[model samples]
Every structure is written in C-alpha cells, then in structure tokens.
Target: MKKILFTGGGSAGHVTVNIALIPRFAREGWTIDYIGSTNGIEKQLISSMPHVNYHSISTGKLRRYFDLQNVKDPFRVVRGVLQAYRIIKEQKPNIVFSKGGFVSVPVVMGAWLNKVPVIIHESDLTPGLANQIASRFSTRICTTFPETVNAFNNRKSRYVGPVVREAIFHGDAARGLAFTGFSKSAKPTILVMGGSLGAQKINRMVREALPELTKHFRIIHLCGKGQLDPTSTHPDYRQYEYVNEELPDLLALCDFVLSRAGSNAIFEFLALKKPMLLIPLTKQQSRGDQLLNAASFERSGYCKVLQEEKLTPQTLVSQLREVSWDKDEYIQNMSRFQQNDALALLHQLITETAK
Candidate 1:
C-alpha cells in the first residue's frame, strides 16, 4: 500500500484542512501517518483517527514579537527538525502533506532533506511566517484564496480554494435542535464561535448583547475551552466549551453565524451557506490575517465585517439584525462558487506528486 505523512497544527485552523483530507486518502487505501507537536491540538484531534498513525515531535511557537522564549525557541525548532528528519527517514512515506503551522515547518524541512515531495496548503490570504519558511522547501503550495497566488510568485502555487470536511454537509437539524434544546416555534437560532481558543472580546460582547438578542434569536455559543459563563441561565441561550462531533448538527440548526474570520471556519460557514457577521482579530492580537480574510468575504458579499475596535453591545445586535436581513443575498453570492472542488484538486496533487 502507498503511504502518506501529514503535518500541521498550533491551532485548530491548521489541522482541520488535514482532517478533511484524511478519510479520502484512507478510502483509497493509503497508509496514513501524522507528525505534530506532542501536546498541540493536532495531537488531540488526529490521534483518535483509527487509520492514522500519529507521531509527536518537539516544536516551538513561532512568535513575531520579542520575548525570552524567542531566544530559546530556535533551539527547539532545530531539535524538532532533527526529530522530524528521523521520522521521515524511517517512515519513508511517498509524500508529505503539510497544512502550515509552526509544527509543520520542521516536517517540511525534514521531507526536503529526505528528497520526498512535499505539498503545503496555505489557508490565509497571505502566508504565515511558518508557511513562508516552509514554502522554500516545498515541492508545491496549494492556496485557499486566489489573492494568495500572486503573493507566492512561485510556479508551484495553485489556487484550489478551501477543503471543507465532508461531515459538515451531512448535519442533522433535528439532532442539532435536540442538543441545544431549541424548538422550531422559538425564535431563529444563531451560532456564535470565537475560534479554537475563544476570543474573550467577542465572548464578552456577545454576553452583553444576549438580553437584546435572545428576544429575536436563540443562541448556541461555542465559547472555547474553559471560557463558559457558568452563571448564564438564559432560557434562550446555550453555551459549550467546544463541540467536535456535534458541530455539524449545530451548523445545521443555526440560522446565522457570529464568528471570527479564520479562513477554515469562515469557509465552512460559507459552504453551508450560513450568513455570517465576522469580527476578525485586530492587529494588536494577531498579524491582521483575519482582517484581510474578513474584508475579502465582505467584498464578495459572503459575510458582514465588524471591526473589533468598533464593537459594542448595541453594534453587535445591529449587525446581527443586518445579517439576518441580508442573509439571502449572501447565500446567493456564495452559491456562485464551487466550494467542494478544493479537496479533489488537493488529493489529486498529492497522489500525482507521490508517484
């Protein structure tokens, strides 16, 4: 049987695309393996897959800011590269597929050193620092946005769009309603997501808006790990730390979305044709990639963007109302794009490159 190795994850966004591709490869009878940080979210998510062999290596965070850890992380990264090199040499997989993250940098480098073909997928409008470094060692780079193609300026860059999980399309609305204790006779349901780590600012604003919002909408809040408000007992509000298996059903039940503008999460919402009000991370919190992702979605009529700095309880409720009013138009515009082809193209690239 053919064998393939995958690597990515500091956050859920980096690992989700790889998750979407795993089953397809498994069905085709490829022996699949994954290399990630020992305690990263990727290890938690991918380790449970029955068909995937998961390997953990030492990895360090790639930070743009100066800190004491910055001086020490380079050494960790070097160690990670050596650890990855040993894994690649032993596994001898046909190809290495990377969803770019700090963990993926060493894996891509190790693959290059082993003379194995490496394909890296970038889900942002512009490459992250890890991907920027991995791109040099990769044989091909797949992008989710057309705008990202020009940024690479490399002949290997291909714009294939985002890979959405198959399970997302098979959501059961009944199961979703049951999970949230929402009724059809009640107000419309809106799902609020703050990304993998949960955005405290967005969570705070949503809680503040609940009194007004619950009058017109039932809320299903995925509040991130350990961020739940235990005192919240609103009849129309439900809170979760996170949902893995039930997420598709939750998406099916939601009439709209209030979310961060991470490319993977937003694209999944877009594919489901859920109207969204996006509050991207500001420059103070991130490299501003979420801002660019939100702007692109807004420009294409896929969602509404609310600048984080301008956010308030009143503004949040107003934007939610606006998104409801404009929901059909956003769905109509999203319908014009073929969102499902991304996985097929990416799978083909990996298969052909492996040969």
Candidate 2:
C-alpha cells in the first residue's frame, strides 16, 4: 500500500486542513502519517483521527531577528531534519504534502533530500518566509489566492483553493445561532475568535469591549485554548477555550466576526459568509503575512482591518456603532468576500495532483 505523510502545525489551521482531507485519502487505501511539533496540540489533536501513526519533533521558530535564540534554530532544525529523515526513510512515502510553518521546515527538507515529490499549500495571500524558502525545492506549490501565485514562484505551482474542515465547508448559520443565544429572526450574532493558540492583544481588547458591544448584538467568543483566565466574567458572554464540537454550529449562527487575520480563521469566516472585522497579528510575530492578508481583504472590501495597537475601546465601540449588519454596504462587502469556492477548488487540485 502507498504511504503519505503530512507535516505542519502550531496553529489549528494547518492541522485542521490536513484532518479535513484524511477521509478522502483513507477511502483510496493510502496509509497516512503525520509529523508536527511536539510543542503544539497536534499530537493530542490527531489521536482519534484516522491515521497509521504520528510523529513529533522539538522545533523552534526561524525568527527574522538576529537573536541568540535564532542561532540555536539551526541546531534544532538539524535535529528535527534528522528525526524526519529517519521517519521518512522508514515510510518511504510516494509523496509529501506540507502546510508551511516552522515545524514543517525540517520535515519538508527531509522529504526533498530523500527525492520525494512534495507539494506546498500556502493559504495566505502573502507567503511566509519559511514557505518561500521551502518552495525552491518543492514539486508543486498551492495557493489560496491568485495574488499569492507569484509568492511561491514555482513553475509547478497552481492557484488551488483553500482546504478547510467540514464544519465550515458544509456548515449552516441557523444551526450555529444556538451558541450565541440569538433567535434566527433576531439580530445577526457576531462570532469572535483569535485562533487556537490565541492572541494577547485581541483577547484583551475583546474582553474590555464585549460587555458594551453585546448589549447590541448577540456574541459567541472563542478566546483560544487556555488564554482566558477562569476568573474572567461578564454577563451575556459565552467564552470558550476551545469548541471541539460546536465550532461549525457557532460560525453558522454568526452575522459578523471580530478575529485575528490568521489565514485559517479568515477562510472559515468567509466560508460561513460572516462579515469580518480583522485584527492582524502584531508585526513582531506574523513574519509579515497577516499584514498583507489584512490589506488585501480591506482593499477588496471583503472585511474591515484594524491594527492591534490602535484597537482602543472607544474606537472599537465607535466602529461597531456604525457597522449596521442590515446595511447595503455590509451585504456588498460580504459578497466580495466570496471570491471563490475555496474548498471545492482545493479538492479538485488534490484529486488532480494525486492522479
């Protein structure tokens, strides 16, 4: 039987995308394997998912800054690559599919060194430094946006749609409104999120601004895993560290969303047809992709983008005050957001690639 391995994690986006496609691969009788960072939730995440086995490696971020810690990344990467090399040597998979992140670096390289066909999927309009570096050696590159086409610069690269989980891909908002406590005929509920790992600035601002905003709109906030203190409290607020089951339900119920401009979250929101207010992660952490995504989404009028430091309570409330979900502008903007059927497009790409 043919074997296949996946490598990418740290954010739920990477792992979730991989998980979404497993059922499709399994039906073809392929043996699936995974390699991700031991530091992340990947190991626990895939336990129940269908897979032959999974592996983990200690990995560090490749910071653009010239720091002493970054110097150590080389050693860590070497160790991770060796670990990946051994894993790959054992599996001898026909192909490797990687979502780009720091954890994927050694895994991607190991596959390349072993002469395996590799494909890269970069979901953001702007590619990450790690993806750009790895693209040079990949057999094919996949992108979520047409603009990201040039970022990969691979002749084999194509404009494939995004790979998103079933919940959002096949979700309905009427079903999700239960989590927001809003009747379907009532005002549109807003879903707030900061991805799986969480964002400090987003969490702080939402905590302060929500009580005021919720009076006007029903809200469901996913505060991220382990980010919200148990002591945190507010009336009419439903907070979750993670929503393993109700994720699709909540998103389907929402009218609008305030979230960090992570590629995965953005795709999920768009897939659900919820208008968005995006806060790009601080420049310090994004490796420049969040800023680019926010800009692109804003220019396209798909969503409003706000800088993290500039997110003052009064300013947020003021913006929310004018953001009437009933307005023609909101409808127009959201229409622009449905740029493509990302999931269907991705499925077609994968099917073609597998051929």
lDDT for model 1 comes to 0.92
Candidate 1's TM-score = 0.98
What 10-residue stretch in candidate 1 is worst by lDDT?
179-188
lDDT of 2 by residue, 1-355 (tens): 7777888876777677777766767877888898988767776677668654788887878777788898788899899999998899888987888887888888888998898878878888878777887787788888888778976665777886656677565655666655555555554566778877777777777678876777777667788777866665655566777787677777766667888887777876666556778888877776777888878777766677778878987677666556554335755766665356555665556556655
Error of 1 at 263 (Å): 0.8
Best by lDDT: 1
User: How would you encode candidate 1's per-residue C-alpha lDDT over 1-355 as one tens digit per residue?
Assistant: 8999999999999999999999999999999999999988899899989799999998988999988999999999999999999999999999999998899999999999999999999999989999999999999999999889888856989999988999999999999988888777557889999988888988998999889999889999999898999877698999998899899999999999999999999999989999999999999888999999999999999999999999999999999999998888998998986764899999999999999
Model 1 bad stretches (over 4 Å): none
- Alpha carbon lDDT of each predicted model: 0.92, 0.75
Residue 255, candidate 2: Cα error in Å is 1.2
TM-score of each: 0.98, 0.90
